[model samples]
Target: MTREINPFGLRMPPELRELLKREARLNGRSLNAELVARLRTGSDPPDANDPPPRGMRLRTTAVQPRNGWVPTDAERAMLTVFRKLPPEKQLALLTLFE
Candidate 1:
C-alpha cells in the first residue's frame, strides 16, 4: 500500500537548520525523514551518537568522566540493575562499554 505524501515548507533560523542537517547526517536519515521522526516522537533527539551508530561511536569514544559527574535517571536505574548482576556478568556487560 502506498502512503499519501503531504508537502510542507518550514522556516527557521540558519543555526537550527544546521543542527537538523547535522542530526540527519549522524542519524543516517534524510533531513525530511529526521524532521518527521522528531515531530512524531514529540521529544528531543538523542545524543549525537548515543546508541553508537545513531549517536556516539561507543567502542571508540573515550570515557571523559567529569570532575563532579553524576548519572542521569536512566544511568542510575541501569546502575541499580548492574549492582545485582553476578561478578562474571558485570564484567561481561562492562566490556560492551569498554
Candidate 2:
C-alpha cells in the first residue's frame, strides 16, 4: 500500500541536508523514505556510521553522590525498599539510582 504525502519546506544547514542525502543512499532509501521512517518510529538519531546528517548522540552519565549530600524523604523510602532487596538487587538498583 502507498501513503500520501504533502510536500513541505524546512530550513536547516546545507551541510546537514547533504549529510541526510548521503545517509539516505547508504540505507538504500530516498531522503523522503528515510525521513518518513524516522518520523514514524520516533527512534534515536542515527549514529556516526549511519549517513552524515546524524544528530548528536544521546548522552547519559551515572549520578554521583556529592559531598554532604543528604537523601530526601522520597529517597529514604526508596532506600528502605532497597534494604528489602537482596545484595545483588541492591547493587543493580544503586547503579540506576546513583
Candidate 3:
C-alpha cells in the first residue's frame, strides 16, 4: 500500500526554483514530481549492485589529514551544516570547491 503525501508550502530563492523547473522539464517530469523524486533519492542509500559513475568512487570512510589538524569554530560549524545536506548537494558543493 502507498502512504499518503501531505502538502507543505516551501519558500526558496527564485533562481533555485527556476533551476529546478528547468531540470524537471529536461527530465520529462512535472515540477512536483521532480521535487518528490529528489527528496526521496536524497536520503536513500546507494545500491550495492550499482556501479559507481565515471570519475567518482564511493569511500567507506572519510579521509583524515596527515597531521590531524584541528578545525576552528567556524570550520566546525560549516562542517555541521555540510553534513546535514543531502549527498548530491554535498557532492555539488565539494565539486564547486574543487
Candidate 4:
C-alpha cells in the first residue's frame, strides 16, 4: 500500500537545510521521512539521553510534608508576603518557584 504525499516546496536557510540533513543521517532516515515524521509529531523526536521536561522533573521530586511538619519563620514570612500579592502578581511570583 502507498500513502499519497502532496508535493510541497520549501525554501529554508542553508544552515537549517544542513541541520536537517545531518539529523536525518544520524537517525538513519531519509530527509523526506525525517521531515514528514517531524511534521506529524510537531517537534523533534526526544533523545533517549535528554533530561525529562522541567515540569515532569519537578513533579517527580515534589514531596508532601508530614502532617506534623511546621513552616520555619523564614518560610512563614515569605508566605505572608506572597499572600499579600494581587492574584496576577501571585501567579507571576509562583512561576519563579517553578
- How many steric overlaps are in each model, in order? 5, 1, 0, 0
lDDT string, candidate 2, 2-96, tens digits: 45756788898999888777656655679888777667546664332332222312223333444546559996686467557754464455457
Best-to-worst ranking by lDDT:
3, 1, 4, 2
After superposition, the stretches of candidate 3 with alpha carbons farther than 4 Å from their true spots are 1-4, 48-98
User: Best candidate per TM-score, number?
Assistant: 3
Model 4 global lDDT (CA atoms, 0 to 1) = 0.58
1-98: candidate 1 lDDT, tens digit per residue: 12577678899999988877876776678888888776765465444333433322233334445454645999768857866775446556756886
Who is ahead in TM-score, 3 or 4? 3
**Pairs clashing within candidate 2:** 23-51
Candidates in order, TM-scores: namely 0.43, 0.39, 0.44, 0.40
Candidate 3 residue pairs that clash: none
Candidate 4, residue 21: how far the Cα is off, in Å:
0.3
TM-score, predicted candidate 3 vs. hidden true structure: 0.44
Error of 4 at 28 (Å): 0.6
Worst 10 residues of 2 by lDDT: 51-60
Model 2 Cα shift for residue 38 (angstroms): 1.2
Which candidate's lDDT is highest?
Answer: 3
Per-residue alpha-carbon lDDT of model 3 for 13-52, expressed as tens digits? 9998987886676556888888877777656776544433
